[model samples]
Target: MGLEPFSAEDPIFEDEDVLRDSHKPEDLLERDRELEEYQSALKPVIKGARPRNIFLYGQTGVGKTVATQLIMDRLQEDQEGYDNLYVRVVHVVCKNLNSSYQVAVKLVNEFRGPNNKVPTTGYPPDTIYEFLWEHLKDVDATHVLFVLDEVDAIGDDDDILYELPRANDNGNVPADETKVGVIGISNKFTFRDNLSARVKDSLCDEEIHFPPYDANQLRNILQQRAENAFVDGVLEDDIVPLAAAFAGQESGSARQALKLLFKAGDIARSRDLEKVKEEHVREAEPKIKESQVRNELESVPTQSHLTLYALLMLERQEDLPAKSSDIYEVYEIAAKRIDADVKTDRTIRDRLSQLKLKGFLDVDEHNEGPKGGSYYLYEFGDIRPDMVEEVLRDVDRLEDLFQKEITSY
Candidate 1:
């Protein structure tokens, strides 16, 4: 019946924002090689030539976006001295924009600003592209570099990718007035690999790949961040190393490492502890993983959730690494329980493959020589079964199904 009083000034964190994704460090550590390559990719911009359409691909939490920001900042600042060159950098995050149409509209809105913003729909793709080109011309810059962050979210609909880089050649924008370029950033490596040949040839004029950090590199990054995030000496000696090791061993994600440090500090602060200790880091690991799994699940289709839930059922029954057929059976039952449509076995297999690609499942292909042929086995990947079940149970339609216990197949 009592609320704890908020502390006016107390320990754990000095500046928590530094540990977050939004915080852009002045210098990127341990990425000199990649940065050098990235600088080389952007060198044409400084010389007042047409900027290359740069493609940056890497796994999540690698410094792709951060590095792009740093280089973009430097590019803009350095270009200021060039009297003949007027450079403008436009950044658009395509995470929520799923298609080329949507991305073009987003760019149009970004270029047009608030007063002249257009609606999200109703415009044809060509019309949107026209609007984008007109806005690019109106900006009156000598060179315009558009940074499409999370460009993979546009998926296979890559019209913007193909068209943007060719706006000058295609005469959408006159080359003599303003030259346009694209700097696409993607966390998914497969996105670049799957691009159509024409789009790849246009958008990937210069490609830079960022490798994940190792444990030592992660430790160095953590130390740099912690120096700004946490109060001096409040973090135990082993705290940064432990968090870095957890993240490095798993995904080598700088974001995950920072999340662990932030969560551990949060735990310490909640307990009113003076220092973030090793135990706090250990305690934050599963929680961070669960949160990550939950966030990933939020984006997946409902059918993928059902497929994963089916796997969870098999995992609980110790029927792990079950075949797609077996998972299809469970998936049918679960789907029927919620009055959802039961997809075909082939569709379930497709879902399984997608889940595997998303790191939600581990798939093994079994070759059974002539007669037995080949089949695939499926099971949970790094994510735990309990975590999947817990997250799935939160789904409103599936909550009732989870209440019903199925002891047998």
Candidate 2:
């Protein structure tokens, strides 16, 4: 058969960009309460007072970043009434930035412009802070807001969070020239709880919590995007509700809900179907979940992969909910079979703990009476054993192990 020709006209999508994460809607829907609290947090800026350091906490896809962008846009437009006030917002996504020094360098580079960018390393932490302060003075705005997205990635090195909020009081920048405030956005619920007392006091002056959207709310959000995303008659009546139910019951993430609808549309267009039906959305569910699992698996270390593989083997033999000691035994054999370095049992346990934290494993702790000790049992969490095996096979070193079926010692 000849190669299929490209379609002359597309029928499914009118404006596909509307469904994307980067697209910001003019108004946030179903977020009135959170938005009110958010507006109240920034009310000081309009009155020519220093802006409060705001902490926005929520699970992923609950509209934290989008809501912030919406408020910032409105704040800029309304500030026109005040002649003396100047407001500027600098956004930095710290997902890959791990230390206070790196985040400081990023801020300095943002203020210094592209041509004056600094290397990621080779600077002392104090010098970086000084440079940041110098650049803040140069901006010369009455109030400057730093929106640090995924601020939890900085981990224990939270000096940037503590310092930026106190830049004026600490004499880093003159109090009259530029007042700096930090707005930290984190998807990790424990990020705020893990902050040091001093950092919490300064950075979390005003906290706003965004709860996950329920089914009705997800349906409304999906319907709004669907109007702009697909051609008017392309979506069947039940499409939005089914997608919303899946996302609402599973994650309650607006982003996830939107993604499901987008994927279903693509599937319909692929089959050259006129309308998106229930089957299309049903098919899209597993594809989206598999993609999410693969992306997460790629982020972990190789040792973690071996640890998970060992669990997969035990699960296949109906031996799951196994203890760490039993897992270590299988893990050691798998490591040797692949000719990989064998980690000590303690180290293997650490890898197991890391995998558990990443949501790849479920763990239960058991304790004996007073004189006895405590131990934990492990099994796959949420993810299926076959899915874990499939993804692990993609790793070059683990490929041979799967082929040889060397699961037993």
Candidate 3:
């Protein structure tokens, strides 16, 4: 095989990672106001004083965590200049660590590093928390900052939130010397509201709400990103504004806007276009959605999606709504044909409900005759039957079943 040139000519991008959501720029374009407020919250850390616990709430793509990180970087830089103040920041995405014990284990592992990490499981909550406190003491950090991103994922098990902020004061660590601060960042307001009162009080000593960006704000964000992302004269005038408009109309997510820019550029590059244009962004939107749906379908458990497959077959093949009872009958046959275990009728119904909640299916409640109780008839919600069939065919055991029926419609 011939090696490609290291400096191949490219049109769409100067540096593509600039458009990635994970790529944090030196600063956000229009987040100066939020940054100032966030800076004030962390400024006390500069003087060797422990800052208040902070709860940051905002919709996705807003700059809650972004502003936090930028201020943290500033704080760290300032602390570096000081002789007495020392600061440590440990960031963990609590989505993957759902339980308090799991989060504590993650903290212990993060502090200890990979070679000496603890197991993800098998540790009791107390032991895990003790391990975390021990790591805190061992590091000798005068102040420890924990950024619990997507903290809603911790759900009802918010023991970590209740305890971590008070660890030093609670005698888990030496109270007089080191201070620990927790910053909880969440996209869901309901999750924050639903938190235990004790957890909320300790974790929300200071609260900030990051409102969704307006169209102009999103455009500014895209503009900052595009300054580094695309080469001059590559993107047409309408590209950034249109992407921002689309993202604004939906959720005003800067992440979505950035993703759109990346997707549009990617599409143009794949098609060997000279530059990214308005049409490229138009084409990229559906591709992004298709990819998202495929991923979401893949994440559903096989048994759960088996129930979905049954509904897909019923809804598409027979051109009818699928009742729980009818879906179970089809599901049992499909399960047996695929050499899989058939769940109980009740389990099948529960799976259907779960699939509905997952946005692949919709359920309509209906009352039959006076003697009959209400029943739910399932149909595709945001998902199409063809797409469901298409995605399910990716599973090896179900490949043949998703194909065209030999006997016709």
TM-score of 3: 0.76
What digit string (tens of lDDT, one per residue) describes model 1 on residues 210-304?
A: 98899999999999999998888898899989999999997788999999999999999989899999999999999998787788776566688
Error in Å for residue 386 of model 2: 5.7
lDDT against the true structure, per candidate, is: 0.88, 0.88, 0.80
What lDDT does model 3 reach? 0.80
Cα miss at 35, model 1 (Å)?
A: 0.9
For TM-score, the strongest prediction is: 1
lDDT of 3 by residue, 1-409 (tens): 9985576677878999887767878877777777777777876777777768889998777877777777788778878789977898998888766678888888888887668888987877788888888888878678999999988777778999999988866888784567788899988765787888998878888888888888899998899889898988889999999999888876677877788889999989877798898998898877766665676686565577778877776775774587788888777877877778888999887778777765778788899889998888888888777877777888776765656343322
The better-scoring model by lDDT among 1 and 3 is: 1
Which stretches in model 1 have alpha-carbon errors above 4 Å? 300-321, 325-354, 357-359, 364-370, 382-386, 389-409
Q: After superposition, how far is residue 262 of candidate 3 from its true place, in Å?
A: 2.0
**How do all models score by TM-score?**
0.87, 0.84, 0.76
lDDT of 3 at 375: 86
- Superior by TM-score: candidate 1 or candidate 2: 1
Off by over 4 Å in 3: 1-7, 113-115, 293-378, 386-409
